[model samples]
Target chain A: DKKKQLQQLDNFIEGVLQEALEEFKQVE
Target chain B: MEERIFGTECEYALFHQLPPPSAQGSGKTAKWSGTSFSENLQEMSHLLVCALRGQNRPLAGEFLANGGRFYIDRGSHPEYATPECRSVADVIAHEKAGDRLVQKLVEEAGGLMAEKDIPGRLHAFKNNHDPRGNTYGSHENYLVSPRAMEKIQQIIPFLITRQIFAGAGKIPHLAPPAFSGEDWLPFAVSQRADFVEHVLSDRASDARGIINTRKREITRSGDNVRLHVILGDSNMSEYALKLKIGTTALVLRMIEDGLGDIPAFLQPVQALKVISRRPAGVHAVEGAGSGHTALEVQSIYLEKALGYFSSHAATGEEKAVLCLWETTLSGLKNLRISPSGVIEDDPGELSRKLDWVIKAWLLNRAREKKNLDWSDPHIKHLDFRYHDLDPETGLFERCASLGLVDRVIEEEAILLAMEAPPHNTRARLRGGIIGEAWGKDVEVLVENWESIRIIAKSKVDGMHPFARQRRSVNGLKANLNDPFEGCNEALLKRVRRFLDKCDEV
Candidate 1:
């Protein structure tokens, strides 16, 4: 159960950073 | 012993990402100008200050109804000093509330800007350094006894290692690696480590050090002094903030109770820089061990604190701080970063609880995802955005929205802290005074942390009998000399006595 939650977190963080990077690029 | 008082002063960085002239033609949202730090940030800060309703201080800042202070510090950074807190939880709630307060002002200022047709998003970041290598501060203030002040050096080793958990993490241009040249350090554990040049210096802006020796006498009894700490980073994580303040207070308590003979760093500033830049490496914590890492030094402090508090009565907060301190150290023991500055292994739960860990993990993940190096400008932007205050665009806020990060304080508590001061400390009186004075038909000036001065708008009736006879009334003053006193009926009486007579009311 913990591992599954951890996987979800990893996905969440990656998605967040990915979106942030792309958005930042457009502004730059 | 008198109830220990704790406070945090955070100077938040203002970032304006102005859309270029070419992008103005497009429908996309604005972002930071290619410039590292924009000048509009200062103007935007001014807008926030101007939107505040009443003058709360004689200076440029306002004394908040929450018993806190918000003002623009040098370099035009918006700063918030949390009300004096006796508990770690209050500190966390109030500190986070500062972020909310500034953010609310940012929106107000943005509205003001819209009237002016300013074409950019004003992003306020709770961070220490900008991309241009200029560093500000997130200073801590604790009321320690005169005895603790004498043995202040005993706390240095613990502080130097405290960055293992308390650091807000930064990606630096002039990165410090143990070896120079091609060995590029892409990220550091601390934002202010490179700027700190001494162990104990009275100076703050330059020759910065572990302890800011500029002292303030808190009580007339000469029992307590304000230990102004300028070494830490502005943290976004409530858990990190709690542990940072909690453990530092505990160590200082131990020092007061005579927990002498702890480890000391031979070269304090040098060790701070090296350990911050290279935490996972085999760096010996001098005066402690041949193989003692930063983790070891921190553990020694924890164990000593544990021993002392085991005999001495500790609050539930202090006990919890000890547990978190230990767990964080244990978690940092497993922290893994490659020599090239990519995080090899991110501690799962600790990443949720600490600012630096989560930041390092996210930045490392970004680097690996795009096959980018540590020095990539894209990664740098993401790094800067991690501290961004906007809930929609901030990377950390995004993670928080998804419940990826662990929270120590409740959302309700944070919101309440925006207007209400902690009930147990002199902040309550200060907040009450500020609250009573707000919107009252009086000219009020908060002279400093200790006193609030108020005068009536109407001339004759507002005056005291003596002042009326002499035709000389400056104002009524409420000077809260003792921080432990939470209620002042006399001050409230004076508040009523003056403001009630005002015809403007």
Candidate 2:
């Protein structure tokens, strides 16, 4: 369960960063 | 006696793909492909860890350091989590240390990136949201007992309204297509508000709640409840950060004592978003089985806190927090009643203390100066620039230099905090071990906040977060559990002996 939670958090962070990076590229 | 320890975990993105100053000087803006940027960031993370290792900095579980931990988090962004702090002042100091450390890493890596012709200078922002409606976190962690965890629902009202003073103000941009024209606000009190979608949830990423329930406690002690708050804005103003944490601590104390008189908001998630969008207006939010404005709800908490302080002995820090809270509430009330929607009598006073006020003042002035509407892209850029970690270019630093914003922590304190842990709590012990291990060249394993193993000697267990103890193989034990103890000479001596024994073996 702990591993799953950590994995979820990792994925969430990656999603946020990926979306931001993509948006940043478009705007810049 | 055990004391509550507060800490912060700040996640920030590095824009390494942008053109470096050297590249821009050549009259060309160079950009790295996203793939290359990710690869180079991974390489830089390794180099950063190596650099810290070279300095003999004790690393825990590969990434955690003495003062804090640094690693490449998800999406290749670097995250820093400060060691446990005893006070809100310590929280601010350690958080600033992170900003400095990251800036140092960027500057150091800039040379290497230049050598590799990576083309872009890395920039980090401490703010919460990006321009594309995505938000990251500057999550606050507070150590509490299991008993205090029961009072979380009671504290939600206070959290919902605190953004009036605590929010790192953001310009509204890119309203969702589902929203009608009137739903688009000109500005918001919080940068993280629009992204919040839950009233209470264990999940942090998809449906982020005001108070997170992801149950990973850094301290192994069974008694502590780690209160992870993911709702707040990433504040640049020291005063805002201090008040935000300090006032919440005081309120938690009140709730634990059963002295809380908090109202229940009807739709807390919607109320949170509304409060951030319409900070100055008195909107009806159902609370206390009736309708109340955010200011009114905040006033109730402030009054209860004041009453609590009056009945019980309040510390100097608590007193200062109460004074600031009262002053901020008054400022909000005054702004609501004012015809001009500006504090003309002492515009600079609140601007110097509150994050949202300061930012709103700056944005309003810029809007007037540039003859641009609030929806201008440049306004959003200015908002992001307010949180730039660079002292030379960050708008908040410029405001501080101009005496438009106030600071609680001293510069020297922040610099000291970068290397040294807080004097109180188990962090000092952790930091001492790291320092000694580095000095003696003894290989040790740092597991977490509570456990450290001396290589081939013994495992030092600091089970109680507040209790500092030293145990040896020969049954020579010393107790230094008191949080107020300034020096850990006895423990340091024991650690040195253990390192020597390990080396001899």
In order, what fnat does every candidate score? 0.12, 0.06
Backbone clash pairs for candidate 2 read B468-B481
TM-score of each: 0.89, 0.82
Instruction: List clashing residue pairs in candidate 1.
Output: B17-B31, B17-B32
Cα-based lDDT at residue B16, candidate 1: 68
Among incorrect, acceptable, medium and high, the docking class of model 1 is incorrect
How well does model 2 score by local distance difference test? 0.68
Give the distance in Å from residue B353's predicted Cα in candidate 1 to where it truly belongs: 1.2
Q: Deviation in angstroms for B72 in model 2?
A: 2.3
Q: Pick the candidate with the highest TM-score.
A: 1
In candidate 2, stretches whose alpha carbon ends up further than 4 angstroms from where it belongs are A1-28, B20-66, B176-185, B220-222, B281-290, B336-348, B456-491
Writing each residue's lDDT as its tens digit, candidate 2 over B170-253 gives: 766654454333323456778888888987779877799998888774654556678899999888889889889998898888
- Angstrom error at residue B321, model 1: 0.8
Which is the leading candidate under DockQ?
A: 1
